[model samples]
Target: MALDALGSPAAARDGMLDVTRDGRPSARIHVTSRGGEGRALVLVHGAGVDGSFFGGLASAFAGRRVVTYDRRGCGVSSDALDGDWSLDAQAADLAAIIRKAGAPADVVAHSLGSLVAMRALELAPGLMRRLVLIEPPLFVGLDPADPVFQNLVRAGQALAKGHTSTLFMLALERENMGDAIRPFTQDELAFRERDVQTHADHEAGWMLAYKPDLARIRAQGVPVLLCMSERSASTYHARNQDFLARGMGADLMRLPGGHNAPRDYPDEVATRLSTWL
Candidate 1:
């Protein structure tokens, strides 16, 4: 786990891993390895979207082996659609990938992916060196009957029902994104459209609860940095941030964009995370 400062960009190595779960071919994860090995940095994406959205951000960490891969049943990964799709399952998948990348790897995850990353931490605490979580809605300190939770359910349903625009709006509102979304770029709209088919797999994660023992994480000396922004001022976000900062001794980083900061402001997030790393 000898980590060096971020260096120049290296050529990417792309491959697909035949990763297994329950002694079966559960996933064929499409992995992209950017830069060369110094410290392995694994980027875990949230629901509905794939690893492709992380291209811009991964490039910033040039030689530090920025690894981005689609989770099971999302993007090009195999659809183990029958089994449990909860955070626990996702954590197992993450553990396999982290083991592939080598131990004590640095992980940077966003949204739902952050939840999976933390679950993996619980499952294999020694597998990770540190974590950079971007607006992970852990739903720990928040009420079950809260409006944000309701909106998230709605967003998931909207995504399942092919209501793409409605899903987008609900996602923004859930993250407390302001009045902007007027004209989505071609790339922006296209990404959502492409993810529509994969929404069913992600929607299941919404039902899962995240109740990590913060003291244990802190005791392990595994540093966790929770990154959010002014725009991501939802109650869910605030509660989790409070829990992590107060309970886990985790660091809080307020970035410039919303919960989707990793995709929206990859360069800025990368710059901040690189310096922090």
Candidate 2:
């Protein structure tokens, strides 16, 4: 497999697949695959970004097939939102991708993507063999009065009050990711900017209201690894990861860098993933 100048898988290996829900054509997901042998390792991205968000990290899984796809309404995937932004629908999309990649694949999901992956595992047990959840914003587990939670609510409210999605997304990245976004290239930043509306309009509220089915996930008996960035360990994201690690009986990994560690410090994240998986 070839890598681009940025160390991401080149566009020559890109593919497209249609995701169906209830036997109806739902989304046209853009997928990128590379590497060979071993079980497929699927990369699921979070909000405000697309599958390319994992470009830096996906190429590091030596000998294992790595797959990454743009979620509906984000990246090069279907732009039609309709009712597809719901958590169930997003999970269904993930399930379809896992099935296409061959069942029993391992998954590495970041932020909101982690929630979708967990829900997918619950909805269709045994589709994924191992799970790595990276700093998922499981807000339900956090204190309602916490400053971060309160600020998130305010951000949403501001969006409802007529803030531009781009501005909202910029604020969000600054707040949650801080200087982590600085290491990303200009093209990467533009890619995320384009999908701000999809997140600000359709996904943010749903993410805030989502309640993880921890019992079902725990019952699945799938081995899970919870990853938290060193910088984020002092924020609400770390709290959420800590809560999930305990609830799901998952092994905790402390990686270098901030929330966007996979992008800023891909080799380090990949090294840990290789060891964990």
Candidate 3:
């Protein structure tokens, strides 16, 4: 289980298969190495999306032993996990993954996973050497008074009604539809549908329950790079990224494409991240 050989399909980067919490019927953990000798760098995906969302960044850091896995109820992970399903739960899952893999490595988390990673650092301050977050949704939290919250609630309700296909269609038409969604691959569609369904239900509970605990994350004293899309300039995502950057006292960098840049333009995202890496 040397750190360099972490890409075997049959085993995780650490050559171990440890299930931390398993009350769900289909709970599983996946870990793969992108290749490197130093401490492993783990990538945690955002809400609705699975670990594949980091395709671009993953490929970019192929030289490093990068690990990315689906969170509970998303993608290959189980949806039947009990309890509140808050960020803390995800953070605990991450801590387990880290422990199973080894201990204390860098982490690159996106959106919802960023919140989870932040909480992980709070629970175990030595869990990560550094952090890279892209467009975390925690800045605004869940504003019940905001129209976006209403829209999310409505969308969740629709997906709960078995309207994932319809929701996927709207997402394709309205969203930028990165390579991950183009030409409508069945696998991609199925994955997207799962993400939509997950977000539409109990997964939303984790997102909506997030409260900014900036002091806790700062206390970890880890170097953090906050990133967002250059195209998000005109959108509220820009303001949100700025808010998160200021709140976390981290550097903010911009990448090409919109919110789905990691899928649409992984090369470019990887190029920008190389400077930091």
Candidate 4:
């Protein structure tokens, strides 16, 4: 099933691509491709979201081959984790996807997805021509004593202790989006529930523990466009993006709307992406 411009199901080209790592079967990823020309641009979604999250954004790139896929267990991708689900594993999955979609692709990754793309770039150099990272949550450089960071850590701990994923995600949205938070439709809620069951635990645990190899990424010299939302309520993400921009020597672009700008402001995001990519 292909997703429409608003991320709803519609008729379009879709396929299931098998991803492998170290000569072993890794995942059977559900991929959707659209548009006409230019370098293949892949959209990598963040935690608790799937390829459908980029449906609207994907439609905006009219002339570029835009590929969006459900990352491993998210959406319709294979859910058999086989007890090995970490950021590194996700990065490998991404590398395989990039190779299948067309190597030297341009990537636009959001939130935790940015981390996965960065890791993939480090692991598979020259696979990506350009990268656009949107608000990666890197708490490594932040002061642990800060109240905002403390709250975020506590929320993760709650999830680790079996706190309700719905409530956890609601709290997260409130924190990040503040008054801009909107009600999720029934389908959106269902997707969120499935994603939470599949990835929330790992996201709260090992994913948070994973750190990027900034030095290796810098050495590769892949052009990066770091994006942050103008109305994001969280200081954690803003500070982290600033740190990342400086560390990677990336060109930073500020877009309107909250952290989920692709959903809320697809036109603006696409315009900026077209200019950058």
Candidate 5:
């Protein structure tokens, strides 16, 4: 999809929903099923953000079953004020969603969710028919002092300051946030601010432990399709994603725009999946 083509029309219709699981935090899964005979697809959001991150892309896949949800402590999910949230714990939450929703599923995950989904496969080997990972910031074996790591730390801290909507707008002035935040409310900036604060601690924990999941995913030998934005070439993170694509033997596909490809080019992503899947 062209950047302008992605508007409120493609944004996800979201709500609070839950699922059952044993000895684990109750799963808070969200759904956006447009109904098609294609493989059931589960969409997982990134760290510091909720299931709503997939709103645009999920809507684009209107002909297929698309499920998106908050990880523990974000969006409508339970806040882990003081509890467990290892990568495995997150994976267990995902497993519950897949089993409850039933099978022949393709799991599409972005950023941090990509790592969690990879771990979920170890918990249940055949849980998914395919895996689509969008730009996971996996930095295993890379220098922590690398510019990319430093940039992430800086961005996380800025996001932690609770100015997300404004900051997001400033960072990507071309994006039409006016439409994107509509289902959210006229004061959607406030909602973004609250969402940012909701996961502060979880974000911190995830950021500190982020690097090693790359090896974990690579060692698992799961079928994966890693996507990068066409503009990813300009940044270290995108280059890192290219490195990950090479290491995982995963398909290195490109969407129309930059880092926020899902949001920026929902239609293109949808079209790509239509052909790729």
Candidate 6:
């Protein structure tokens, strides 16, 4: 990747850093760093998306160096996502991003990225000085026997048959997210198509692996900010929000828009983040 500076002096410089384990390539994370002297701020995007999703939060953190990266298989990174994609592997990738950012950084993650960030904290707690999770779907306060799980299972089955649009809409309906996602622009829909299956793969593995025993981690261990959307449709997401705030003693943040608040209301979310931090 070219180390060419961005058009603006303050624009982040894009690069690719290899995150390896046992001297083998684990992942090639695509990163953008707005270099600064202070501790870095790393933003991890959610499922079916990449770091560009954090474009809204960029200027809000101008004074400090902020970094963003694509998770494995989601964007321009390596899709070495065969077999079971355990949360451990994803978390290790996150930790590597932190170390590449010069370590000891503040982390802000959204959706599935929240799960990765939390596990990263557990893997290398010292890398995070502060953490923020936005509408994490940890499935707390959810019954294992609920039909929703079966619906989700069926959705995955549909994905295996190369039916993306229907599977996606079904997921939105199940979350009560409505038809707002319909009428996608050509480019937006293309991006989603590339992302949805990788997301499904990760979700499948996450279900089989992580136990969602979030209470095992405590608020006292690290400073945490728990953010939620005032309009998020998923009841399970809300449950996780409340559970994390109460159990982790996290600072509660209610933002505009729904589960993908950062993407929907970039300016508002960025402004709030600036004010809070």
lDDT of 2 by residue, 37-93 (tens): 557788999888888778778766666678888888888778643456688888888
Better of 1 and 3 by lDDT: 1
Lowest lDDT block of 10, candidate 1: 1-10
TM-score per candidate, chains pooled: 0.80, 0.87, 0.77, 0.87, 0.73, 0.81
RMSD of 4: 4.3
Candidates arranged by TM-score, highest first: 4, 2, 6, 1, 3, 5
Work out how many backbone clashes candidate 5 has.
1
Q: Residue by residue across 1-277, what tens digits does model 1's lDDT show?
A: 1111122234576667765666776656667777776668999987767787687778776667888887777666666644655667778878877777777899999877887887788777799899988877666666668888777678767767767678767766655542343344453455564455555445433533467777777777788898877676654787567866877788888887666667667677788888777
Candidate scoring better on lDDT of 1 and 5: 1
For residue 28, model 1's alpha carbon misses the true position, in angstroms, by 1.2
Candidate 3's C-alpha runs over 4 A off are: 1-17, 21-27, 80-84, 141-187
Clashing pairs in 3: 73-78
Clashes of 2: 0
Weakest lDDT window of 10 consecutive positions for candidate 4: 2-11
Model 6, 101-143: lDDT tens digits are 6667788898889889988876676788788888775654456
Instruction: Summarize candidate 3's per-residue lDDT along 134-203 as a digit string, tens digits.
Output: 7765526444665545555665455667676554443233233234443433534557877767766655
Q: Give candidate 6's whole-model lDDT.
A: 0.69
lDDT of prediction 3:
0.65
**Residue lDDT tens for model 4, 183-259:** 44453455776776676655556556767777788889799998888876466787577677778889988887888
- What local lDDT score does residue 241 receive in model 3, on the 0 to 100 scale? 64
Which one wins by TM-score: 2 or 3? 2
**Model 5 bad stretches (over 4 Å):** 1-27, 30-32, 141-145, 150-191, 211-221
Q: Estimate the lDDT of model 5.
A: 0.62
